[model samples]
Target chain A: MRIEANTRRGQPVTIYVDGTPVQAYTGETVAPALLASGRRAWRVTPWGEPRGLFCGIGICFDCTATVNGVPYVRTCQTPVAEGMVIETERPLERDQ
Target chain B: MNPEPVHTDIAVVGAGPAGLSAAVAAAVAGASVTVIDAYSQPGGQYFRQPNPAVDPDPQEPRPRAGRELRHKAEAAGVRFLNRTVVWGAFEDLRLAAYREDTAQAIELQADAIILAPGTYERVAAFPGWTLPGVITTGAAQTLLKEQRLLPGQRIILAGTGPLQLVTAAALVKAGAQVVAVLEGASPGEAILRQPGQTLAAVWGQSTRLKEGWQSWRTLKKAGVPYHRGWGIIAAEGKDSLQAVRIARLDRQWRPIPGTERRLEADTLCLNYGFTPATELAQLFGVQLHWRPAQGGFVPRRDEQMQTNVPGLFIVGDGAGVGGAELAMVEGQIAGLAAARQVLGDSTLTRRIEALQPALRREQRFQQFYARLFTPGPGLDELAAGDTPICRCEGVSKATIVQTIHAGADTMHAVKAVTRCGMGNCQGRVCGPLVAAILAQETGQSPERVGQFRARTPIFPVPLTAFTVLTTEGAESAESRN
Candidate 1:
């Protein structure tokens, strides 16, 4: 979670993750918001194992989630947008 | 939809210390310079910027330095293409990129190219490493540095090198309860054994020593345990990290049998070292030589940082595992050298020659760094049977070992048969891990196993990006969206 009292941040933005609204700021990426909102498993693999932000950078695709109908977008690289719906659980269906 | 390829006298593939400095030098030398970086902003990881809202950090100097470097580049007529992915490098210095915001496919035809692609943290696989809360030391540092966020309430920094102390100190300052910092190698012992060489390596690097001292001071104030000759064996948890199992290690880093201890923590930050980002340079037909201590398979380059391929130069950690200071010096030299070639002017030769001393000093530090921090060979045997090696495909150590034993000895064969490197990450994350697995199983050195053959479109590109360029047509060149 952001150290709200200590740090200055962009304007507040709300994005839905698995149908739950997550509060974020304008300048931050989706990965931080996702982790801050208490969602660690950004994506559930085909084996049903949980994976989160292994490499916060874009190199690892482990943090990919469906963002506003775009499947497999890296949350670590993607910025948080207002009212964006991020679907993580039913990821396989979106890809198909 | 600029159908006409973007033309530039020099094209740089990163915006880190090396690339930024190179861009500034070349542009200042009367050459048109364009740099492309995957990040939304300049200052690749080493000089990674914090949120613009955050005040300049007193402990971290790189972010402020990065801002100045970017400004210097801009003032020198260096154009930056941020948030652009260079997915492919083709013949005759051509590059294919996708602009994220505009959804457009772009191409670059350059006179000369400098690659400062940088390094990615190398992680050794252990049981539960695939858990939700286990992340690399670099990842955690990115979280704290860039986003002003922490991965968990209580974090354990387990890695080799000064990065462990640095990350722990950062975590502590950010209000997280840092449980401990477990250094894989015995650097304290290293300093004691080679005090003279240590002084030589660290002689010119006062700021580095000061930074290490500051981190130690911060950890000491918080009463955080800084364990040398120790490291984590595995991360243990249900869905996320609940604890880390650690143990004492011998000189080779093999965990001692009776020294097992489990420390409760919500997050586990792990790193053995790093791998040079040689994929892009390799795809550009640059020859690679195995330099394990330099983070494996770095591109071969001349003193001027020019690769075997004419007009192509690679610098910084991308060429080898040298730190940011070395990268900047090399960047300047390469920039001056490349600009001299393109503009048909030898006037910049003196400026390039002057940077040799700084470059040599940084090289000395780099060697000292490798000797002190590079973990023992025992790290290669970290993965257990069920431990996942291929993070992209979820391929396990058991499957990989079996594949190697079944005569899939080569890196390519193992990848092909088991789908090890065939995933969204395109083998970047799992390539090193699988190579180690293959080597352990076959009793061959990782160098003998070779690397995964990189192809065009090294990074995954969305299909829709292509349609935008095609639909816009060549006549509507320079369409900004």
Candidate 2:
């Protein structure tokens, strides 16, 4: 559950996560928005372990998720857009 | 398929305080300046401004030092390429950067290049550190400062340096319950024993001293226990962070046998200070020297922030782990020096001369802080054999030790054999840990273990972005055949 820390609000937008509509803000990154919605696990490893948002920066890439059909997009770096589709546990093909 | 190289008088690789200052100074000196940063915003980590859409109090006046520098640089006609990642440094000081918005690779050639990539938080490997709720202090601050998001309901800020206190205060203000602050150094020793040095360090920096005092007062008023000479030995969690095992440390920072205590915490913010981000400098073949006091291997820079390479300059945390204040001073000096070289302007010398005193004072404070917050020896022993040291590859400490025992003497060799530093991070997170492990096992100095040689594409770029280069190479090979 993401706590409301302040009173400032951006234009509320809806982004689909795993085909489920998740509410997000216009200026927030996808990672924080997902965390705010209580979806902490962005990706599941091949070993079935869940990982998400380790560094909170682009460097770690742990927060990577499939966004708008593109796999391994760093959710922390990618800002949320209205109607953006995000998938959490899509397996990255070797060629991709 | 090669992209046309963008030419600039001065190319600043980072938009942090150091890079921003350098770009502004050079632009003010009538030189064409281009500043590039991976972040969409101008401020580096230290001045991470909030995104208006996410920030509840978007109009709240936070620190504007970084914003002011960025604005000044922009006003001086300095070009800023935000959300661009510099992936490689090539011959003649050329840089290859990937633009995130366009997914295109661009080359930049500059008369002079300033590298100020800043630093990354150094985290010691402990059990359960890879858990979901375990994060670096910088990560916590980024969440709070940028997103106004608290890490967890119950958080424990454990680390050394003034950053812990500052982060704890921020977390408290943000309404997170800061259970306690575990500092590795003895507060009395750091404050009382070195009273003269502490006073001298803060002598000219009243604002900084006041900030520190205010943070301390905040924590004190909150009734949060600030344990001195204590450190986290392990974090106990199954899926995410539920608790952390902390212990009292001796002078050498070794944990006392019977002093272990477990604290219930939903989040564990681990920060042992920062390590210089030297991938670009290392890629450029700039010389690096190990200065343990300055937080490990850093690029060697002269007084003017110029590296051994004539046109290559490094400042900020990229050169060393000096804070933003020193980074600004160094950046100004470097910018002035670079401008003098490229524009043949000697008038900038007076400005550079004027910054020397402030630079010296900041340096003095940095040295004192470094000495006071040196990571304890016990931190080296925190990673058990099964603990994951390289989070990128999920390589365990045992695997690294096994690789070492199997005759992989150097870090490069170990990486080659175990793929410890070959993950998405490209050794940024595991490089220091592996080096420390190698040093401990082989009895070789960290310098002797050596850092991983950074290859082209320092940051991971999309494979599709490289299709043009690959096609060109294929075409050339077909023509030769």
Candidate with best lDDT: 1
Please provide, for model 1 over B334-434, each residue's C-alpha lDDT reduced to its tens digit, 9 standing for 90 to 100.
Answer: 99999999999988999989999999899999998898888876777878888888887889999989888889989989988999989988888888888
lDDT of 1 at B385: 89
- Best DockQ among the predictions, by candidate number: 1
lDDT of each: 0.86, 0.83
For model 1, which pairs clash?
none
Docking class of 2: medium
Q: Report how closely model 2 matches the true complex, as a DockQ value.
A: 0.58
Estimate, for each residue in B89-174, the C-alpha lDDT of model 2 and write its tens digit. 76666777888987877777899999999988888898888888888888788888887778788899888988999999888877
How far in Å is the alpha carbon of B365 misplaced in model 2?
0.9
Clashing pairs in 2: A8-B56
